[model samples]
Target: MKEKITYQDAGVDVKTGYEAVKKMKKYVEATKTPGVLSELGSFGGLFQLDLKGYKQPILVSGTDGVGTKLKIAFMMEKHNTVGIDLVAMCANDVLCQGARPLFFLDYIGTGKLDSNQAAQIVEGVAKGCKEANCALIGGETAEMPGFYEKGEYDLAGFCVGIVDKDQIITGKDIQPGDVLMGLPSSGLHSNGFSLVRKLFFEKEKIKVEQYLKELGDTLGNILLTPTRIYVKVILDLLERFSIKGLAHITGGGFIENIPRILPEGCRAYIDTDSFPIPSIFTLIEQLGRLEKKDLYHTFNMGIGMIIVVDPKEVDPITKFLENKGEEVYEIGKVGRGEKGVEL
Candidate 1:
């Protein structure tokens, strides 16, 4: 008689997946807000819309992945913080639209299931959700044995947020004389890793643990820094300041992202010497022999979020952000001309 095959034989272990979910319950529940109506193990996550604060509420949603930054995590064998990167990637985008993050869901897929590692990753997600003041409602743990290489996993997150329709920051008000305030990033912030990996590992042949004096941290730790979530800061600023525009600098760096929020016949003239750029970016530039423009067009280069406010509000807003523990830079100003960025 031919042997019968079980689902487990096909590499899908229902039992192990259940155990992993069971372990992640506490972390998920810890991120629950008053709006979350479903438990962690439900088929779908539920969030009750809160309409108290707005006359016209609009839902804003964004989805993003950690990019090749995951490769660094795989190299370092550290899965904890990448989950935060996943959340930040989505949460910050919606924030650019003046949305208050409501709840987040994640999708994780791997070749093999490692329950402990899975739990660590979820805990990071939960921590990120809590930091952003959003609930962690649901996620998928897909174990495809042969599809991914052993011990490799990819993560993506979906975030839903709400904003008052009238309060949406479309940058329509951004005009000449608006000052651009830059908020510092916590390292690379989950973008441009494809080039980063090539420069550090393939070209430079550097090991994860190898220490560089300029970096002040090992290559592994520097690469794994969690992407910063700007939800709270943006929300707070929206309440107090007349922010003309907001830009979350990601994949295409300053050049690509800032243009997204600019109105017609306006340009951003950034003084490159205005802020203290972290050393990691300089290291990459030197090692790769990349031009100055390419360096600014790729990495965060220090600033993570940019705020365009009236020139008069620059001093007070800068002071307010400084008091709130943000590293603020008066990096540039809006000028009349082309609708692009200049540095």
Candidate 2:
């Protein structure tokens, strides 16, 4: 008799996938709010937009992945923090347009699903959604046996938000005499990890668990630090301040991201010494022998989100943010120049 074929034999376990989803339900329920109308296992996530306060409600959506930082997560066998990075990458982007994040969805694909690991990863995502005050409506967990290595996986996130048409903070209004206020990052905030892996794992052969005096933390812990979610803080500032432009510093670093929100004939003159950079960056620079330009172009360099406001509002805004338990930095000012960032 011919051997019977099964989905499990092909490396896909419907049972395990269902179990993983089952494990994620509690985390999903933790992010529920008034607008969430769909349950965790629904065919589609339903979020009834609550626009009672807005004259013109505009939807803002952003999608992003953790990028090569997932590699670090895999290397350390730490699946938790990368999910937070996934949500942070998307949530922060939508907030740039002055939107209040409403709901979020996630995607996780792996060669073979480990129910426990998948649950841990989704736990992080739910935590991040809670931090952003967004609902974790629904998401996908795919187990494709041959696509990814047995122990490897990839993650991504999508976030939707709503903003009033009149309140959109496009960079068009950014002009000279505007102050650039920076919110400190928790750490790397999930970018530029390809180079990081090359330096630490490929070239130096440093073990992920190795402890360093300068870092005061294990290499794995520092590298796996969860990305910061700025939705609550930024939303609070929006209510009280006239923010001209907002920039979520991600992969492009200062050189690339700052220019995105600069209007024509406007330039960002950044003072490198305006704030203290986390020691992780300095250690990377010293160990990798990377140049200053490369460092600023690749990583957050300790500054995660940049807020542009009128110069006169700088003191009050800084004080407001500081009072809210945020580390605020007057990193730079908008100037009339060639429409680029100058460090």
Q: lDDT, candidate 1, residue 60?
A: 95
For candidate 1, which ten residues in a row score worst on lDDT?
318-327
lDDT of 2 by residue, 20-40 (tens): 988999999999999999999
In model 1, pairs of residues that clash are none
Clashes of each: 0, 0
- Model 2 clashing residue pairs (backbone): none
Candidate 1 lDDT tens digits, 217-283:
8999998999999888889989998988889999999999999999999999999999998999989
Cα deviation at 151, candidate 1, in Å, is: 0.1
Candidate 1 residue 160 Cα shift, in angstroms, is: 0.4
Q: Report RMSD (Å) for each prediction in the order shown.
A: 0.8, 1.0
